[model samples]
Target: MQAFLQQLPALIGVVIGALASFAATSAAERSRWRRTQSVRWDERRLTAYAEYASAVKKVISLSVRIAAHRGIHPDIDALPPEEGLPALAAAEEERTVKWETVLLLGTGSTVVAARAWHESAFRLQRIASGREVELSWSEAIDAVSKARRRFYEAAKADIGIALGDVPESYDWQISRLIAADSTPPERNT
Candidate 1:
């Protein structure tokens, strides 16, 4: 009896240590789970953003070509006017799909930016296709350019990426588009 009584404190200490270890392990596991979820969600958001932006840009490109080909912007005709209608329609359909995905997966601010970008691009498309009001090529370009910049800024904020860290290719593309509108397109000889 005396021996058992003497050993009771040691047994209690062992039990407490085991329980402490178990608690720490459980906490660590929960924290790891949360981090994994965060990383997964971040990846999804990035994919959505990229897909949406790419699709919208495709539509914008088609609109510009169609407009030029149709003499809305006669100086920049890169394609025959007849060829542009089908291509623009296809691009618009693709943009609709991508925009739905953005609506599903995007954060609030990101969704707003995406919508703004789409609307701006759509306005230009309507003008180019003669579906609605007419605008000069430069006017349409300026509106879309602003909208694109706004979307990129919002996306950067949402993704926690510094503006300077954005890919050089993206910067160059936007810069080129804006520059393209700065002066009239040169007539090909």
Candidate 2:
């Protein structure tokens, strides 16, 4: 009994030291894992966000030009039955691929907002291209405008790394729109 009691202190000390070492190593490993994933996700999300934004903005510009054209010509004149319709169709198809990638890579809120924006944009583009029918042109335009704003809000709020150092010259009009439309509640959330 005396010898066992004498050895108990050493065994206890060794067990405690082993546990401490394991805890320290585990904590360090966890921190390293988190940092690695943080950088990876940040890079991925930024790339996808930028691509999606570029695609959507291109569509929006075309839509705006079409609407302005309709305004310039008579209501009966309609958009020139030109290649613009075909071009818009191709862009929308490509946009679907981009949106799919964005959804796969983006976070939850970003994914949801992106889907909403893309759906609305898709409907608007279809109408503008005359590939589909729309009851009211104004409604389509308004939907596109809202979707664009929502997309910007979702992208701006993401903590993507490249988002921090994004060049100002890339999309001046887009930045202006985001700034003007994305409220604090919309972004900070």
The prediction achieving the highest lDDT against the true structure is 1
> Candidate 1's residue-wise lDDT over 62-158, tens digit each?
8877666655554344665467678878888988998888788777888888888888888878877767656566666777777787788788777
TM-score between model 2 and native: 0.65
Error of 2 at 131 (Å): 6.4
In candidate 2, stretches whose alpha carbon ends up further than 4 angstroms from where it belongs are 1-11, 72-81, 130-138, 156-189
In model 1, what is the error at residue 89, expressed in angstroms? 1.4
Encode model 2's per-residue lDDT on 47-91: one tens digit a residue: 888888788766666654454344421122234427557666667
Point out where model 1 deviates above 4 Å: 1-5, 74-77, 134-136, 165-189
